[model samples]
Target: MTLITDTISRAAITDSPLLATLAERWSPRAYDADAVIADDTLTTILEAARWAPSASNSQPARYIVARRGTESFTKIHDALIGFNQTWADSASVLIANVVDTTENTNPWSVYDVGQAVAHLSIQAQHDGIHTHQMGGFDAAALAQAFGLTETQTVISVIALGVLGNIDGLSPELLARESAPRTRKTLDELLLVND
Candidate 1:
Protein backbone atom coordinates (compact mmCIF):
# COMPACT_ATOMS: atom_id res chain seq x y z
CA MET A 1 0.00 0.00 0.00
CA THR A 2 1.35 3.42 -0.96
CA LEU A 3 1.35 5.83 1.96
CA ILE A 4 -0.19 9.26 1.28
CA THR A 5 1.63 12.08 3.07
CA ASP A 6 -0.91 14.86 2.38
CA THR A 7 -1.83 16.38 5.76
CA ILE A 8 -2.76 19.91 4.74
CA SER A 9 -6.08 20.97 6.21
CA ARG A 10 -7.91 23.42 3.93
CA ALA A 11 -11.05 23.73 6.02
CA ALA A 12 -12.75 27.10 5.89
CA ILE A 13 -12.04 29.57 8.71
CA THR A 14 -15.58 30.86 8.98
CA ASP A 15 -16.47 33.74 11.34
CA SER A 16 -19.36 31.73 12.72
CA PRO A 17 -20.09 28.03 13.03
CA LEU A 18 -21.09 26.40 9.74
CA LEU A 19 -22.19 22.91 8.94
CA ALA A 20 -19.20 20.59 9.03
CA THR A 21 -19.95 19.46 5.50
CA LEU A 22 -19.94 23.02 4.15
CA ALA A 23 -16.92 24.11 6.23
CA GLU A 24 -14.87 21.06 5.29
CA ARG A 25 -15.56 21.20 1.55
CA TRP A 26 -12.51 22.13 -0.52
CA SER A 27 -11.58 21.45 -4.13
CA PRO A 28 -8.62 19.10 -4.65
CA ARG A 29 -7.04 18.20 -7.98
CA ALA A 30 -5.19 15.11 -6.84
CA TYR A 31 -7.52 12.15 -7.13
CA ASP A 32 -6.93 8.42 -7.03
CA ALA A 33 -7.09 7.40 -10.71
CA ASP A 34 -8.03 3.87 -9.81
CA ALA A 35 -10.84 4.83 -7.47
CA VAL A 36 -14.34 3.90 -8.62
CA ILE A 37 -17.49 5.43 -7.12
CA ALA A 38 -20.30 2.98 -6.52
CA ASP A 39 -23.47 3.47 -8.51
CA ASP A 40 -25.57 3.86 -5.39
CA THR A 41 -23.33 6.56 -4.00
CA LEU A 42 -23.44 8.41 -7.30
CA THR A 43 -27.21 8.14 -7.29
CA THR A 44 -27.39 9.52 -3.77
CA ILE A 45 -25.29 12.51 -4.75
CA LEU A 46 -27.55 13.22 -7.77
CA GLU A 47 -30.56 12.76 -5.54
CA ALA A 48 -29.31 15.59 -3.39
CA ALA A 49 -29.05 17.82 -6.45
CA ARG A 50 -32.50 16.77 -7.60
CA TRP A 51 -33.98 17.97 -4.34
CA ALA A 52 -32.27 21.35 -4.41
CA PRO A 53 -34.63 24.34 -4.39
CA SER A 54 -35.46 25.95 -7.71
CA ALA A 55 -37.43 29.11 -8.48
CA SER A 56 -41.12 28.17 -8.47
CA ASN A 57 -39.97 24.53 -8.68
CA SER A 58 -39.04 24.98 -12.32
CA GLN A 59 -36.03 22.68 -11.68
CA PRO A 60 -33.84 23.73 -14.60
CA ALA A 61 -30.78 21.77 -13.47
CA ARG A 62 -29.57 18.89 -15.61
CA TYR A 63 -26.43 16.74 -15.51
CA ILE A 64 -24.47 14.64 -17.94
CA VAL A 65 -22.77 12.04 -15.75
CA ALA A 66 -19.73 10.16 -17.05
CA ARG A 67 -17.57 7.57 -15.38
CA ARG A 68 -13.81 7.40 -15.85
CA GLY A 69 -12.33 5.44 -18.79
CA THR A 70 -15.44 5.81 -20.90
CA GLU A 71 -16.08 7.55 -24.22
CA SER A 72 -18.33 10.14 -22.60
CA PHE A 73 -15.75 10.85 -19.93
CA THR A 74 -13.05 11.25 -22.54
CA LYS A 75 -15.14 13.70 -24.52
CA ILE A 76 -15.90 15.74 -21.41
CA HIS A 77 -12.29 15.71 -20.25
CA ASP A 78 -11.01 16.65 -23.69
CA ALA A 79 -13.29 19.67 -23.69
CA LEU A 80 -11.41 21.04 -20.68
CA ILE A 81 -8.50 23.45 -21.21
CA GLY A 82 -5.29 24.51 -19.46
CA PHE A 83 -4.62 23.24 -15.90
CA ASN A 84 -7.99 21.50 -15.68
CA GLN A 85 -6.86 19.09 -18.43
CA THR A 86 -3.68 18.32 -16.49
CA TRP A 87 -5.06 16.65 -13.33
CA ALA A 88 -8.78 16.02 -13.98
CA ASP A 89 -8.01 12.67 -15.59
CA SER A 90 -7.45 11.12 -12.18
CA ALA A 91 -11.02 11.84 -11.12
CA SER A 92 -13.37 8.86 -11.11
CA VAL A 93 -16.22 10.86 -12.64
CA LEU A 94 -16.76 14.00 -14.70
CA ILE A 95 -20.20 15.57 -14.74
CA ALA A 96 -21.31 18.29 -17.10
CA ASN A 97 -23.46 20.79 -15.17
CA VAL A 98 -26.26 21.61 -17.58
CA VAL A 99 -28.88 24.31 -17.31
CA ASP A 100 -32.11 23.97 -19.25
CA THR A 101 -33.30 27.33 -20.37
CA THR A 102 -35.81 25.60 -22.67
CA GLU A 103 -36.44 28.61 -24.90
CA ASN A 104 -35.85 31.19 -22.22
CA THR A 105 -38.42 29.47 -20.05
CA ASN A 106 -36.73 30.39 -16.79
CA PRO A 107 -34.81 33.57 -16.26
CA TRP A 108 -33.24 32.16 -13.11
CA SER A 109 -32.09 28.90 -14.71
CA VAL A 110 -28.41 29.53 -14.12
CA TYR A 111 -29.05 30.56 -10.53
CA ASP A 112 -31.06 27.39 -9.91
CA VAL A 113 -28.27 25.30 -11.39
CA GLY A 114 -25.86 26.86 -8.94
CA GLN A 115 -28.09 25.89 -6.04
CA ALA A 116 -28.25 22.31 -7.28
CA VAL A 117 -24.49 22.13 -7.71
CA ALA A 118 -24.04 23.52 -4.22
CA HIS A 119 -26.23 20.75 -2.86
CA LEU A 120 -24.28 18.20 -4.85
CA SER A 121 -20.98 19.50 -3.51
CA ILE A 122 -22.22 19.36 0.05
CA GLN A 123 -23.51 15.83 -0.43
CA ALA A 124 -20.28 14.69 -2.09
CA GLN A 125 -18.31 16.08 0.86
CA HIS A 126 -20.61 14.25 3.20
CA ASP A 127 -20.04 11.06 1.17
CA GLY A 128 -16.25 11.36 1.57
CA ILE A 129 -15.55 12.34 -2.04
CA HIS A 130 -13.81 15.45 -3.36
CA THR A 131 -15.20 17.75 -6.05
CA HIS A 132 -13.52 20.36 -8.22
CA GLN A 133 -15.87 22.44 -10.36
CA MET A 134 -14.41 24.05 -13.47
CA GLY A 135 -15.78 26.72 -15.77
CA GLY A 136 -12.69 26.71 -18.03
CA PHE A 137 -13.86 24.41 -20.77
CA ASP A 138 -15.09 24.40 -24.35
CA ALA A 139 -18.81 24.67 -23.79
CA ALA A 140 -19.57 24.66 -27.49
CA ALA A 141 -17.64 21.48 -28.18
CA LEU A 142 -19.11 19.71 -25.18
CA ALA A 143 -22.57 20.68 -26.30
CA GLN A 144 -21.89 19.40 -29.80
CA ALA A 145 -20.40 16.14 -28.53
CA PHE A 146 -23.33 15.60 -26.17
CA GLY A 147 -25.86 16.79 -28.75
CA LEU A 148 -27.24 19.35 -26.30
CA THR A 149 -29.80 21.81 -27.55
CA GLU A 150 -29.19 25.53 -27.66
CA THR A 151 -31.54 25.90 -24.74
CA GLN A 152 -29.46 23.42 -22.70
CA THR A 153 -26.15 24.92 -21.64
CA VAL A 154 -23.18 23.20 -20.06
CA ILE A 155 -21.86 25.97 -17.89
CA SER A 156 -19.44 23.90 -15.80
CA VAL A 157 -17.89 20.50 -15.32
CA ILE A 158 -17.30 18.75 -12.02
CA ALA A 159 -14.41 16.37 -11.32
CA LEU A 160 -15.18 13.96 -8.52
CA GLY A 161 -13.19 11.19 -6.87
CA VAL A 162 -11.41 10.04 -3.74
CA LEU A 163 -8.50 12.26 -2.72
CA GLY A 164 -5.06 11.13 -3.90
CA ASN A 165 -1.57 11.74 -2.61
CA ILE A 166 -0.42 15.34 -2.58
CA ASP A 167 3.07 14.07 -3.33
CA GLY A 168 1.73 12.81 -6.63
CA LEU A 169 0.87 16.37 -7.71
CA SER A 170 3.39 18.58 -9.51
CA PRO A 171 5.22 21.16 -7.43
CA GLU A 172 3.03 23.95 -8.80
CA LEU A 173 -0.11 22.01 -8.03
CA LEU A 174 1.19 21.03 -4.62
CA ALA A 175 1.82 24.66 -3.77
CA ARG A 176 -1.70 25.62 -4.92
CA GLU A 177 -3.21 22.74 -2.99
CA SER A 178 -1.35 23.74 0.13
CA ALA A 179 -2.32 27.40 -0.07
CA PRO A 180 -4.53 28.75 2.70
CA ARG A 181 -8.27 29.00 2.04
CA THR A 182 -10.09 32.31 2.38
CA ARG A 183 -13.55 33.77 1.90
CA LYS A 184 -15.21 37.16 2.21
CA THR A 185 -16.52 37.97 5.68
CA LEU A 186 -20.27 38.30 6.26
CA ASP A 187 -19.70 41.95 7.11
CA GLU A 188 -18.19 42.56 3.70
CA LEU A 189 -20.96 40.62 2.00
CA LEU A 190 -23.87 42.28 3.78
CA LEU A 191 -24.10 45.79 2.33
CA VAL A 192 -27.47 46.79 3.76
CA ASN A 193 -29.51 45.40 6.65
CA ASP A 194 -33.04 46.26 7.65
Candidate 2:
Protein backbone atom coordinates (compact mmCIF):
# COMPACT_ATOMS: atom_id res chain seq x y z
CA MET A 1 0.00 0.00 0.00
CA THR A 2 1.19 3.53 -0.68
CA LEU A 3 2.20 5.02 2.65
CA ILE A 4 0.59 8.39 3.27
CA THR A 5 3.06 10.44 5.24
CA ASP A 6 4.76 13.82 5.01
CA THR A 7 7.92 12.76 6.80
CA ILE A 8 11.04 10.73 6.10
CA SER A 9 10.82 7.11 4.97
CA ARG A 10 9.72 5.17 8.05
CA ALA A 11 8.73 1.92 6.38
CA ALA A 12 10.49 -1.20 7.65
CA ILE A 13 12.89 -2.72 5.13
CA THR A 14 12.10 -6.24 6.22
CA ASP A 15 14.56 -9.12 5.79
CA SER A 16 11.96 -10.74 3.56
CA PRO A 17 9.03 -9.51 1.54
CA LEU A 18 5.85 -8.93 3.55
CA LEU A 19 2.45 -7.39 3.18
CA ALA A 20 2.57 -3.65 2.58
CA THR A 21 0.35 -3.00 5.57
CA LEU A 22 2.70 -4.89 7.89
CA ALA A 23 5.90 -3.50 6.46
CA GLU A 24 4.85 0.14 6.30
CA ARG A 25 3.30 0.24 9.74
CA TRP A 26 5.31 2.29 12.22
CA SER A 27 4.31 4.25 15.34
CA PRO A 28 4.59 7.98 14.68
CA ARG A 29 5.05 10.46 17.48
CA ALA A 30 4.38 13.62 15.48
CA TYR A 31 0.81 14.16 14.38
CA ASP A 32 -0.93 16.95 12.52
CA ALA A 33 -2.39 19.26 15.09
CA ASP A 34 -5.24 20.25 12.79
CA ALA A 35 -6.01 16.76 11.64
CA VAL A 36 -9.46 15.42 12.50
CA ILE A 37 -10.29 11.83 11.74
CA ALA A 38 -13.57 11.36 9.94
CA ASP A 39 -16.27 9.63 11.98
CA ASP A 40 -16.58 6.78 9.51
CA THR A 41 -12.83 6.14 9.48
CA LEU A 42 -12.67 6.12 13.27
CA THR A 43 -15.48 3.59 13.51
CA THR A 44 -13.88 1.42 10.85
CA ILE A 45 -10.60 1.33 12.80
CA LEU A 46 -12.39 0.30 16.01
CA GLU A 47 -14.34 -2.35 14.14
CA ALA A 48 -11.10 -4.06 13.22
CA ALA A 49 -10.29 -4.50 16.91
CA ARG A 50 -13.80 -5.76 17.61
CA TRP A 51 -13.53 -8.53 15.03
CA ALA A 52 -10.11 -9.71 16.26
CA PRO A 53 -10.22 -13.24 17.60
CA SER A 54 -10.75 -13.55 21.33
CA ALA A 55 -10.27 -16.63 23.50
CA SER A 56 -13.31 -18.88 23.03
CA ASN A 57 -15.16 -15.85 21.74
CA SER A 58 -15.07 -14.44 25.26
CA GLN A 59 -14.57 -10.95 23.69
CA PRO A 60 -12.65 -9.61 26.62
CA ALA A 61 -11.38 -6.61 24.64
CA ARG A 62 -12.79 -3.22 25.47
CA TYR A 63 -11.84 0.38 24.62
CA ILE A 64 -12.26 3.90 25.88
CA VAL A 65 -11.92 5.98 22.70
CA ALA A 66 -11.55 9.72 23.03
CA ARG A 67 -11.27 12.40 20.40
CA ARG A 68 -9.16 15.51 20.64
CA GLY A 69 -10.58 18.60 22.44
CA THR A 70 -12.78 16.47 24.69
CA GLU A 71 -12.77 15.94 28.43
CA SER A 72 -12.10 12.25 28.05
CA PHE A 73 -9.20 13.01 25.75
CA THR A 74 -7.74 15.44 28.28
CA LYS A 75 -8.04 12.88 31.05
CA ILE A 76 -6.32 10.16 29.06
CA HIS A 77 -3.55 12.50 27.94
CA ASP A 78 -3.00 13.69 31.48
CA ALA A 79 -2.65 10.11 32.63
CA LEU A 80 0.40 9.66 30.40
CA ILE A 81 3.43 10.05 32.68
CA GLY A 82 7.20 10.54 32.12
CA PHE A 83 6.66 10.76 28.39
CA ASN A 84 5.99 13.27 25.65
CA GLN A 85 2.34 14.11 26.01
CA THR A 86 2.89 17.26 23.99
CA TRP A 87 3.26 15.30 20.77
CA ALA A 88 0.35 13.05 21.77
CA ASP A 89 -1.92 16.04 22.21
CA SER A 90 -1.78 16.64 18.47
CA ALA A 91 -3.17 13.19 17.74
CA SER A 92 -6.75 13.07 16.58
CA VAL A 93 -7.73 10.23 18.89
CA LEU A 94 -6.57 8.40 22.00
CA ILE A 95 -7.77 4.91 22.87
CA ALA A 96 -7.48 3.14 26.17
CA ASN A 97 -7.16 -0.57 25.49
CA VAL A 98 -8.67 -2.48 28.37
CA VAL A 99 -9.51 -6.01 29.41
CA ASP A 100 -12.64 -7.35 31.10
CA THR A 101 -11.40 -9.33 34.08
CA THR A 102 -14.75 -9.63 35.81
CA GLU A 103 -14.86 -13.35 35.21
CA ASN A 104 -12.90 -16.00 33.37
CA THR A 105 -9.51 -14.72 34.39
CA ASN A 106 -7.83 -16.83 31.75
CA PRO A 107 -4.21 -15.99 31.01
CA TRP A 108 -5.00 -15.75 27.32
CA SER A 109 -7.26 -12.76 27.88
CA VAL A 110 -4.27 -10.45 27.97
CA TYR A 111 -2.89 -12.05 24.83
CA ASP A 112 -6.23 -11.59 23.12
CA VAL A 113 -6.28 -7.93 24.04
CA GLY A 114 -2.84 -7.51 22.49
CA GLN A 115 -3.96 -9.20 19.31
CA ALA A 116 -6.96 -6.93 19.11
CA VAL A 117 -4.76 -3.87 19.41
CA ALA A 118 -2.41 -5.25 16.81
CA HIS A 119 -5.27 -5.66 14.40
CA LEU A 120 -6.41 -2.16 15.15
CA SER A 121 -2.93 -0.78 14.48
CA ILE A 122 -2.58 -2.62 11.23
CA GLN A 123 -5.96 -1.46 10.09
CA ALA A 124 -5.03 2.09 10.94
CA GLN A 125 -1.89 1.75 8.86
CA HIS A 126 -3.91 0.51 5.92
CA ASP A 127 -6.26 3.43 6.29
CA GLY A 128 -3.29 5.83 6.04
CA ILE A 129 -3.53 6.85 9.68
CA HIS A 130 -0.60 6.53 12.07
CA THR A 131 -0.91 4.77 15.44
CA HIS A 132 1.47 4.85 18.40
CA GLN A 133 0.80 2.56 21.35
CA MET A 134 2.31 3.67 24.66
CA GLY A 135 2.94 1.68 27.86
CA GLY A 136 4.42 4.40 30.06
CA PHE A 137 1.28 5.61 31.76
CA ASP A 138 -0.34 5.69 35.16
CA ALA A 139 -2.85 2.85 35.09
CA ALA A 140 -4.30 3.53 38.51
CA ALA A 141 -4.90 7.20 37.72
CA LEU A 142 -6.50 6.36 34.40
CA ALA A 143 -8.65 3.65 36.00
CA GLN A 144 -9.86 6.06 38.65
CA ALA A 145 -10.37 8.95 36.25
CA PHE A 146 -12.52 6.87 33.95
CA GLY A 147 -14.36 5.28 36.87
CA LEU A 148 -13.32 1.88 35.58
CA THR A 149 -14.32 -1.02 37.81
CA GLU A 150 -11.82 -3.36 39.40
CA THR A 151 -12.58 -5.93 36.74
CA GLN A 152 -11.74 -3.57 33.90
CA THR A 153 -7.95 -3.40 33.62
CA VAL A 154 -6.27 -0.76 31.52
CA ILE A 155 -3.41 -2.13 29.46
CA SER A 156 -2.23 0.57 27.06
CA VAL A 157 -3.04 3.77 25.21
CA ILE A 158 -3.05 4.28 21.45
CA ALA A 159 -2.40 7.62 19.76
CA LEU A 160 -3.93 8.00 16.29
CA GLY A 161 -3.67 10.79 13.75
CA VAL A 162 -2.19 11.93 10.47
CA LEU A 163 1.56 12.33 10.25
CA GLY A 164 2.75 15.84 10.96
CA ASN A 165 5.79 17.97 10.27
CA ILE A 166 8.98 16.73 11.94
CA ASP A 167 9.88 20.33 12.62
CA GLY A 168 7.10 20.48 15.19
CA LEU A 169 8.96 18.04 17.41
CA SER A 170 11.78 18.91 19.82
CA PRO A 171 15.37 17.97 18.97
CA GLU A 172 15.43 14.79 21.07
CA LEU A 173 11.93 13.69 20.02
CA LEU A 174 12.77 14.50 16.41
CA ALA A 175 15.84 12.32 16.58
CA ARG A 176 13.80 9.50 18.07
CA GLU A 177 11.12 10.01 15.45
CA SER A 178 13.69 9.76 12.70
CA ALA A 179 15.81 6.95 14.17
CA PRO A 180 16.13 3.77 12.14
CA ARG A 181 13.58 1.18 13.24
CA THR A 182 15.02 -2.23 14.05
CA ARG A 183 13.85 -5.54 15.45
CA LYS A 184 15.34 -8.85 16.61
CA THR A 185 16.42 -11.11 13.78
CA LEU A 186 14.09 -13.96 12.90
CA ASP A 187 16.79 -16.52 13.72
CA GLU A 188 17.28 -15.01 17.15
CA LEU A 189 13.57 -15.31 17.88
CA LEU A 190 12.95 -18.92 16.79
CA LEU A 191 13.65 -21.55 19.46
CA VAL A 192 12.96 -24.55 17.21
CA ASN A 193 12.33 -25.13 13.51
CA ASP A 194 11.24 -28.73 13.68
Give the worst 10-residue stretch by lDDT in candidate 1: 1-10
Q: State the C-alpha lDDT per candidate.
A: 0.89, 0.88
lDDT tens digits, residues 1-194, model 1?
33333323677877788888888889988999999999999999999999999998999999999999999999999999978999999999999999998845867889999999999989998998889999999999999999999789897999999988776788898778877878787788888966
Which one wins on lDDT? 1
What candidate 1 gets wrong by more than 4 Å, as runs, is: 1-8
Can you write out model 2's per-residue Cα lDDT over 46-153, one digit (the tens) per residue?
999999998888889899999999999999999997564868999999999999988778889989999999999999988989999999789999999999998998
In terms of TM-score, how similar is model 1 to the real structure?
A: 0.93
Please give each candidate's TM-score. 0.93, 0.95
Clashing pairs in 2: none
lDDT of 1 at 144: 97
